[model samples]
Target: MSWIFLFFAGLLEIGWAIGLKYTDGFTRPAPTLFTIASMIASLALLGLALKTLPVGTAYAVWTGIGTVGTALLGVWLLGEPATATRLACIGLIVAGIVGLKLAA
Candidate 1:
């Protein structure tokens, strides 16, 4: 259950991370509100997960998910470069996340 919460929290982190670009420095009201809501929800979910998960493992996995999702979304939606090296690094992050989950 805590892992589920952490996973969703990580997803929300990706939402807000990508939402920042849509917010246009927060000049856009709707995106800004959405981003802010996501931020709060993400933190709340992270707190819930922290009740059982080790802080180090949870934090790394949370940020890892966010980083990977955001980078992929940036390439797919924002026309960012998807270089081989960049993708390999993302894969490494995913591996680390998996390793942490297994260790925990």
Candidate 2:
């Protein structure tokens, strides 16, 4: 389904984002390759999802999932900041994503 593709695309977006952190400005060959692969895969999946989903809504939800997922991964795996405000913002993004899904 388009929604399933979109979900994995969003997850791949998060993976590519985290991979970007490891790439070290593209100096690291393996991580850079991983990042590029994930990026391409994510975009391709997004395109597939767009075949059925509304463009604006799908895009917003995709980016929302990526943003929130990456933030959470950063905190949990990358030792990024975990302040209450940051968590609240992530929650708000989640709420918006849920709202968009519901509306769709």
Candidate 3:
């Protein structure tokens, strides 16, 4: 259940990240609201997951998932470049996240 919470938390982080792009420095009300909502959800889930998960490991995995997910979303949804180098970096992030989960 801790892992599940972390996963959802990570996904919420992705939501916040994408919403940030549309927030225009928080000037736009709707996107800004989304950004705040996602951030709250992410933090809440992280707090809940910490009840059973080690803090350092949980935090690392949480951040890793969020970073990679948001980067991919940027490429696919926002037309951010998915060049060879970027893809390679994304692959590395995935590898690291998976490795952490396995080794945890």
Q: Sorted by lDDT, highest first, which candidate order results?
A: 1, 2, 3
Q: C-alpha displacement of 28 in model 2, angstroms?
A: 0.6
* TM-score (C-alpha) between model 3 and the true structure: 0.95
lDDT of 2 by residue, 42-90 (tens): 9999999999999999999889989999999999999999999999999
True lDDT of residue 92, candidate 1: 97
The segments of candidate 3 whose C-alpha lies over 4 angstroms from its true place after superposition are none
Error of 1 at 21 (Å): 0.2
- What are the clash counts of all predictions, listed in order? 0, 0, 0
lDDT scores of the candidates, listed in order: 0.98, 0.95, 0.94
Question: 1 or 3: which has the higher lDDT?
Answer: 1
Give the per-residue lDDT of model 1 (tens digit) for 1-104: 99999999999999999999999999999999999999999999999999999999999999999999999999999999999999999999999999999999
Off by over 4 Å in 2: none
Cα displacement (angstroms), candidate 1, residue 97, comes to: 0.3
Question: Tens-digit lDDT track for model 3 on 13-69?
Answer: 999999999999999999999999999999999999999988988998899999999
Candidate 2 RMSD computed on C-alpha atoms after optimal superposition onto the true structure? 0.7
How far residue 9's Cα lies from its native spot in candidate 3, in Å, is 0.3
Best by TM-score: 1
Q: Any idea what lDDT model 3 has?
A: 0.94
